[model samples]
Target: MTTASTERTARTFETIGVIGLGTMGAGIAEVFARNGFTVVGVELTEEAVERGREHLAHSTGRAVSRGKMSEEQQAEILGRIGFATDLSALADADFVVEAVVESLEVKKDLFRRLDDIVRPDAILATNTSSLPVTEIATANTRPGRVVGVHFFNPAPVQNLVEIVRTVVAEPAVLADVEGLLGRVGKNPVVCGDKAGFIANTLLFGYLNHAVSMYEGRYATREDIDAAMRFGCGYPMGPLALLDLIGLDTAYEILETMYRQGRDRLHAPAPILKQMVTAGLLGRKSGRGFYTYERADSPVVVADDRTPSTDDLPELRHDIRTVGVVGTGTMAAGIVEVFAKSGYDVLYVGRSQDKVEGVRAAIARNFDKQIQRGRATEEQKTEVLGRLSGTMSLDDLARVEIVVEAIAEDLAIKTTLFENLDEICKPGTILATTTSSLPIISLATVTSRPQDVIGMHFFNPAPIMKLVEVVSTVATDDAVAETVRALCAKVGKVAVSCGDRAGFIVNALLFPYLNDAVKMLEAHYATADDIDTAMKQGCALPMGPFELLDVVGNDVSLAIQRELYLEFREPGFAPAPLLEHLVTAGYLGRKTQRGFRDYSAR
Candidate 1:
């Protein structure tokens, strides 16, 4: 959004040359010509040139059909483009941009040719997603004039363009490119020559981590995608996005990044290689992670793989009355969940003050929903009427299902389970909403170990749509099934898993967040840029630092620490900066500080 600084240029780029006539290249050429610049599109052959011409026609025709453009405008845009079948056609171009295959050798060969063929003073740019810009720049004779203009897919649509600068790039050349991109209605972010520049560097690490989770069979693809789409507000699940991106493309991106960074997080999962080898290239190949109706079709159909389903327990006790312990946000959210679902909910607290606190939390939750026109006064009254406060464990004896939403410590939860074991009726399902910690250890406290299970809910349970139903080795299938079914009754997507550290989301999420902290600690990029990269570059809900602040830095550090202890993998070690921040009591929004300042709020 800043004005481009003045820079020396041989002359303003009056005519543009675009190499390659693929989807990206064609769209980019269309963008230049649509803006009234004469563009020469070069492909290797006449057939490829015709295909490129048709691509432009199809795109502009669709825009006209959709009422986004007039027929005359589309015709004028087509008239501005002149197609050729050789690189020499660009000899007169003032600026030439290469949007060819991602192979380094291919790009190097093309750039070397472009350097010799195009006007010596013409600026050269590469639309590479992850290759080092310096390497590409060095292939040209005038390296000072080379830069990276990384554009997102559908160049005619996405506004972002990463303006990459190499050490040899002259300040004047950089400014000229910046001002040109700005004139084209682009939001350019400047960054140094790096493996992924600013965007892909932060994005691919997170995407690759999700692939690793899938490789480990930790969660079903559906649930993994659902957890993020529902839990984090991501536009799509990781696996689904991988399919849309093409597994082969993703494999190549990860391979390049891993070779350059050597960070474990960038390591491509073995499964990705296998699938790519099988020709499951993704939407282009008709299949990858999920089967689509046809090649390039968006409609997805159920494949041979069976979605994991839990059968409701036939002989389980009916959970007509429920008991929820704790007075924090999670506890109150659980209380609201049960109350709104027409169950008699008994919330237990230590003192009258604690009981009042829980009630206030629930009231505040409903008040906001009501203010937003999402809840009616009668509905709020009905929900509140089902909730009853209790100061004694004796009152919980009548409830059939007792779910404890206390702090994450095992000692506190085990103690609560021990008390509940003696108070609740026999065969009562004891569930813990623990993100981490062994459910079996909590279950072993009671004689009925088979009855205890983990029902991990994302924060703000009333709004978030995911609930992980975790089963310890000792837990009965009926207990897990009952909990999973209850999640459905309360309108949540319940994902079943084994009792493991981090369950599903946290196991996959925290490590990626930890890596982001490492990047920030290493001064790879600023927090705002990293966040923007993930949100705009990867279409994520929030950047890692923003999520860390909301999730609490202490909580994230603690989770990563637990993961390290359980796995003993060097990669799981909490980043030193994150550890020091937690140790300094900068626990995030609750404390008004962490990676960002929330003090003003």
Candidate 2:
């Protein structure tokens, strides 16, 4: 191994060299130049060099147009970067980052050539997202000075940058690179050299699973995309994101990760290879999972796969009164939703006190809404007037629908369904708000299985707008339509899917969270570092660990276990570390501890 000096002093980097002038490379060069460093951008051919130059100008010009940077400043920034068609121009570069293609051999060849051109003290880095940095580093004589600086796309805007350190990397070299990234306004997350590192490893697995869902016709693409956006507050859906990232690029990354880790979850879905082969390469090609308006267009145009309103099942318009069971937060919110939407809501609890608690909860929520100018005193009174509380299931006999938001325990919920079946009228729609339990299992316990459906709602339902309308095999077409229409009437976005372990959101969510746990358990990276990688690197609303802590470790483990049982995929199994956390009674915020400590708060 080529070792660098073990000195602890910080190194000053003035000249930065970037090889390849593709989109990523150009963005990286702009980042360095904007940070006031002299940038030497090298490309193989003059045509490629001009493309890189135009990319920089267009990006900086947009900043000027947006008033983010003055034209004079943009010119100054452009002036700081100098382009060259030869590696000899980088002889004096203090730091060099290779942002070429994903091919290992090509990167190794570039590094070997750089060994003869650049100074021995200059730090070398690869911007490879999936290829092993260590193997690429080994091609050079000074392997100890080589590192991986994986920047997110649109590097000028994205804040997170992963600093991958191999076992042979010198400590000083790593520190200097991290310091340089920090100086350039990037959040640097350091981790051991591993394929996919942090973000892509967790992200692609979830994306691939979504592809598998789409391939199986588990749900319509629009519903699948809307579920994640509305249910989890994700900025974009998996399929849409896959389109933004070229399908071919995503496939190659998954393949590389799978080859290195041998983890089945990282294996690319078969459809991904097929899609790439068909030239359906997402936005660039105008088609992938969704058809774009044209090549390189962000606007999507309707195709044959788009659902038509003319074919929708007829909705039952007779749902005037709704019944909600349980006194929990979800039950109270559901009752509030129904009441506020002009439906008479009858809520049942274990006793009169618990039943009254539901009413009080709704009253408090309405008061807050009124305070926020979202409702009026008369509106609150009118909504409260529409709500009725009772301790007897027999009172639901006159209701048009009954939504069970009780405990997630299978036996407890099944027994409730059996009782609701006996008490409710013949045409009453019975819905369960179970997030993970099989809706079919609950349906089978009732005589009116055709009336049974899953109406899974996110927590704090009064604020959240998503309600997953899951239909079992036995669910009548009209019943699903009626519930879906009811959701629209109540101002909720309902995404339909077949009854399964997790429906859509949880099915796609928890596995990624479990993967984060596995990543932590393996000592690959710290929880905070992993969280930062996701939140900043991938533009996620929250990191997997932060979400897991908020969701409760026990709840997450239960959902993960259900997924494992239903799919029988080894990758679906709950991570042992998560199980241990749950076993220790570190449930979540309620218990004051989980993946993180809440007691301090």
Candidate 3:
């Protein structure tokens, strides 16, 4: 039965009809034409048609200048695309894709009109990013032949295309569309006909949460964006990406998803609507979260929100000698960072052997840097000269600041803070490198709460550039400012935020990973397809599943649980699949079995 159906619907699509001649539509037409399909591009008027023609010419002309294409090939590609202002032009087309405005009524009207003009067996598709594909299919008589073919922006360049299938869609139609997209050099992922599909569903939820963080004054816009870019390795921060996507368009997508799923995570932050109403659409309008040089320009100009150099804060306490606790990798890295920056470092460990082991680790790292030509032998000697190790906590009494990189238990950290408070001087800054634990708990444990802060550094601290500067309610502004300046002195980008669970990076990242798990738990899409949608469609460095597996399902679950407990938001709860995996001891690479088995490797 499958073979017979495949043979019957194996019709080759020769001519493709594209409705709407906007940036996305023209790019779609170019993609099909470049792949040798005859394309009929239809707009509402001749002027619109001419604009689309110019768009194609300009795009291809740039390719020629960049040596990516020849002039003759560009001409041939353009010649295959014929523009028209009437629906009758698509009468003989075998496939039709409507890339019209994101209005449901407009798309339904276009699909209804095309039903009479195209052949009876022709396949119709919508390029919607957030609307209901099943409802749009119901607008035409042959709903089984209609599907959603969503292309990411800049269709010609992006490799991802989402093929959304409604319950009534024929298997043959889906197979054909997937094969066609493959031929056009696109990586297609199939999913159910739902608002936001896969990429936008996960992507917008994160973007909305970032906006809410900004609205609540949890962090400055620059700090929030910098944390994601430097910590998570994302190509762009959420707020900046929202600006490029146009705040108005983002609001619309969020509104549609919220209306459909009723998930509070998808609800547009209140500030988004206010910005859209005030015409702060984003780069297109020269203003949104940031101001641009002009409309449609990428160059960011100075605005009232820009930080001024003249208003910089002065370092409160004169920090010369630094002290760190623990013998773990993070502790060693922190010790290396301080010593390399010309500060005398005194690190304490459980025993003399452990203290010497930290020094050996630093020597190994400096040796590797020398081999890579990133450091000099003389420089390594100078850095090592500044390091001192001891087995007694009393030695930290003379240091100006004590940064605890110890175990992540509150009892252990608070006990250490209490010891340091008694040993160290009155003005010594007591800092903790805890990522998820509350900094205030440790601050309150110390005698001088004003001197305690969080200097949370990323792993391989000698490499990663981000350091989250967290301040508790009792922490003095001078202490936070001094830590921020010290971070700069050591060549780290510092982002300040309130002392809270998950801080900045974990707060935004873990929930998205949890959502991906939920999507898999519901059998909405396979893990591989979800990963591909994010990596290709959203340009993220790694998919949520890949990151979760590397970060350990147990670790991710713990962080997610913390976030849920702190905010009490239902969406922040950890997925049951993740909990089950952790319970089964499928920790991650550490155990050789996680989201995917790696035992063979």
Candidate 4:
């Protein structure tokens, strides 16, 4: 199976043999058969063979039902598949791909048998996501003939396939697998022999880190997941992704990668292993981090009646004036949000001019909301009347709480906290909205560290519901609870976490984006292909590259450096490509020319 001279060329693939017949295996067979290849689908037994055939039919049937494939096309694809219970059926296969179970012994044994049965020139490929392709290749008599074609789950739908080659693999063999993938409408990205290669190599590490955060009780699973989903625009949260990946399978993948790389971040969380022991293997087994209605179901039935806050004492209402600081978009948004909630706000900033601008911006924003019928004229007037900006530190002196959304420089923020500590009353809660900076460091500036917390808000704070209420080791339980209650009062989803760099969101997010850059740097695939694969194949809101551009490479580079410094792991070490881009002034869409050239547009 191969293509040449662009998509204009007709796909030319004759006989292709797909070993194993599970979900991934069946989908692989269907992909080839759909592209007009004579697919020899092989399994261990007649029952398994029939099951594989049914799986293929069901997959194509979905495409037809979804209007992605025509009925005639589905029938034609089914006609091309020939299922057998014997390996000898693949004697004439030009290419034989093994998508068997992820066990190395089982896969190695299958490849060894195939080495004896198939032609010497026949390309050998594996769809194993976590195992070493090199180890699988070494089991064959002609190891150079073996390569990896790691496909994402539901092979017929996902477009990306990682083409892994060992040290001894022939160049021609690598070309053949890439060609075959192209013919089957897949974008092949080449990588070295590594556990979780490319996608999972980067993806699972982040997922494991998220679990560690949850296990540490830094944040609730809901808020931690929400930070990534709403803040970063990920299609699903890390815990949900772990469920989709299968908790048992995710744990196994992390353990293997951790063993190989010896990176603590890749080390499987004990809780994940414990859950697996309890027979909660995620959606496949009907439970994991979350409960599902049934196996293979995504309809979550979370016990909303369950208590949300774990150890908070009963709330006492002693309401008073609140202060909102900073003159940026976020600060203005926050002002509007608090004012809308009927809180009298003393909006403080560096200067009167800046505060005036924030007021004007808030007015313009509310005007648009009124025009869109999202707000009533009376409500807008009442909300605006609640907000008043001031430059005097004395303005915050009378307030019960203050939220600072200043610039992200450590020196400047530390100085601001020091000033707040000296001026504000003893009971005033001081909070910072710093996203990636360590909140603990900010807490260190004040004697009342417990009173100082991280009140993180998603961008355009008035609209986004998620607000991460981060508490440092010294943060008072009372203060944390008060903020949590305040968040609910203002209609925000408040998730709590510790004072670590990136907290839950950026910690899991930036690494995935960095991995994409590394993938492109290594020439595994073009930026376009990787982006397409992620968007079309995984259903992510945006591909990593696109997201990097949106977040700005400088911001991403800063977060990456932070994670790298915190973990001190070689994999977490920021990719050289990112540094180069930053140094070259390619700061994403803000400056244009990131992974792609957006200057013209």
| CA lDDT of each prediction against the hidden true structure | 0.86, 0.93, 0.93, 0.84
How do the predictions measure up, each by TM-score?
0.92, 0.97, 0.97, 0.86
Better of 2 and 4 by lDDT: 2
Q: Write the per-residue lDDT of candidate 3 for residues 439-508, one digit (tens) a residue.
A: 9998888789999999999998999999999999999999999999999999999999998889999999
lDDT of 1 by residue, 1-601 (tens): 8988765444587789999889999988998998888999999989999999999999999999999999999999999999998888889998888898887888988888887788777899999988888888898889899999888888898877888888899888888887877777776777777787777776677678777777787778887888778777889888888899999989888888889889777788889999999999889889988999999998898777745344343335577999999888899888888888989999999899999998888888789889999888888888888989989988999998998988889999989999999998888999999888989999999999999998888878888989988998899877877887888888888887788788778877888898778778877667886787677777777889999999899889889988898888687899999989899999989899999888886
Better lDDT candidate (1, 3): 3
Clash count for candidate 2 is 0
Q: Please identify model 3 stretches exceeding 4 Å from their true place.
A: 1-10
Q: Summarize candidate 4's per-residue lDDT along 1-601 as a digit string, tens digits.
A: 8766553342344899999999989988888888888999988899999898889888899899999989999999999999898899999898888888789999988988887799877878888888888889989999998988888877887888888878899987787778888878888877788787777776777788788888887777777788888776778898988898899888889989988878676889899999989989989988788888899899888665335557543334355677987989998988888888999998887877898998889889878888998888888788778888888877788888999988989999999999899988897889899988888888899988989999999888988888888898898888888988888888887777788878877877787788788778977667776776667556777888888898899988998998888878677899999999999999989897877789898
Clashes of each: 0, 0, 0, 1
Better of 1 and 2 by TM-score: 2
Q: How many clashing pairs in candidate 3?
A: 0
> Please, what's the RMSD in Å of model 1?
3.3
Q: How accurate is candidate 4 locally (lDDT)?
A: 0.84
Ranking by lDDT: 3, 2, 1, 4
